[model samples]
Target: MTIRTFIKTTGSVALGLFVATLVVRGEESAGKAIAVRHSSTDDTATIQVAGLEKPLVVLHITDSHVTVADELEAQYQQYSSRMDKSYGGEKEHWRTKKKALPAAHFLNLLTLAKDRNVDLIALTGDIVNNPSQSSVRFIGKALNDTGIRRLYISGNHDWHYEGMPGSDDALRKTWTQERLLSLYPGRNPLCYAVQIGGINFVAIDNSTYQVTGEQLVFYEKETARGLPTVLLLHIPIYTPANTSASASSCCGNPVWGWETDHGFAIERRERWPKSGNLKSTTDFVDRVGKTGNLIAVLAGHTHKARTEKLSDSAVQYIAQAACNGGSRLVTFAPLMRDKN
Candidate 1:
């Protein structure tokens, strides 16, 4: 059997056991429990814990690409093939092969979050293979099962090609911005703020690839509030100061230099300028730096975990690892110096 088939079979068996464990544990812990509900709120769900004052923990999970059984093996094969091709057709690949178990990896991530006692879970987007209604619903159900206050946004994959069968017009009508917003509000909320532990966490929909005029306006308002802030988005904004050739490097090699050297570009075309300019993102970062209270910018979509200190600013920009197997834990304290 192929790796794809093995993953699917193992995931199915594991899920069955997980459900059984939950049932037995629920029965044993509680005498008579009828319903199991999960938290889907985007706002901060705060709970006071011992020894930690205003402890805010955000679990960042990205790019799970969850799908049902029928599509799982095929989708895995497709992604695996693409990764191999991108790496110059070498079958003995590690990065792609090592991180193919989306379902099992997601379950492990959930278990880790529960173990850490995370206060909130923020999904940076690309939750499904495509914008199929069933896939979206499946993602929602999986997240709800985690029982953590969750926030979801759209990555480019969520609506790039419109996987649902329909005409262009019908696809437009069916997957309207409203419908997508209802499904994934964290991305479409257009710069909403959630306050946890006296710090304002701002969710910006940078999935469009570029910062829009409307988003700039929202950023201005949030900055004016002068509250300690944490910005969350699907894509990490470009920072030129920390470009090095390493796994942890933010802006070099596979990330910003994929095309010239390896025949691939990490970023999609629409979101980035062909001239290879970082002006838009830099402008936004400069504005954010002026805010003084901006703590850190958290993002995903590059699938590589990296952290870079912005030039002349205290704001740390971090990209979490892909949810397929990558993991990142972001901690925010209420009283950090406003160097950024």
Candidate 2:
């Protein structure tokens, strides 16, 4: 089947999940206007907006989950077009689901962004299913072709495999730092900050649960400048379990997914550092609280859109997928202060 047809089918399945996340969580979209329409066509239009001191249009998208050019696919595609290994049939259910999503959705989303003429695009993570060289190359070129400034981070899948053991070397081969640098330019692509249209867009590789000291240092330096900062990353920071599971859930270690969070395989995979204890979650959140200019946080991983407040000044916007023809628009309105 053609890529577009497959994603439309997957999106039909994901629509119910997307609807479940759309409760009126007060001010989650930052009091900006949002419109979603369903139709039989491109499903896009330009939105005219005003009333912000410094206005920048951002297209926030993620989790294309495109299983493009995997080593297995390279080895097996000629023999069999189907992409799953069967995993003793446990993998049976998801094989089609994976195939139903591809890098084509990213290209389609780029079309929407281009139509909207977005000033910037932030792909939160999981742009590819397994960080395959071919997938990354395709995504990078399409994104550049949009002629929009871009920012990104790697998700867990973008690095390590799901339930697969000790594949960091394999991951390194697929997601080479050079490839990482091409999309993200900095001494450390995993964490850095860039300025686009008078806002500080900070990206951190909280892809792992730990907040590395080096990342914290980068945070300090970037926030010191005191520009209105919008933090972007793969996973969310840990929040306490609320009555609603989704609200409480953030950060994917103890990894969140199809399987239960309790198991030897998953637990063994979630090892902590042997030496230095980086900042505590509270300490880091406290630092963010003090960073007066910090405004927003953007992320993806659950493959379900969500939002959770970080501090009085900051709210985290979690996206579901750009793969199933999904994208979110973020407007950084002029900084408004309480008139107390």
TM-score of each: 0.61, 0.67
TM-score of 1: 0.61
**What are the per-model C-alpha RMSD values against the true structure?**
16.8, 11.6
What TM-score does prediction 2 earn? 0.67
Q: Scored by CA lDDT, what does every candidate get?
A: 0.49, 0.55
Which digits, one per residue and each the tens of the lDDT, describe model 2 over residues 1-340? 3322322211221211000011223432122221111111112212111223456888888777665565634643432232222111211112134333355556767887889888888988877655446666778888888889888877765654444445434444355463555667553665778888767789887665446666777787787674567798877765553235543335532334334333325323444434323444445545654454555678776666665545434556666566665667765544332232
lDDT of 1: 0.49
Q: Distance from true position, residue 19, model 1, in Å?
A: 48
Error of 1 at 182 (Å): 3.9
Model 1, range 1-340, lDDT digits (tens) per residue?
3322322111111110000011123222211111111111121121112122565787877766554334543543433333223322212112345544555666767887889888878777666554555556666666678788876666655554433344333433344362455655544454677777665677776654445556666776774565555677776655555454433222211244223323123321222224442445445655654444454566666665555433222234343444445555555432221132
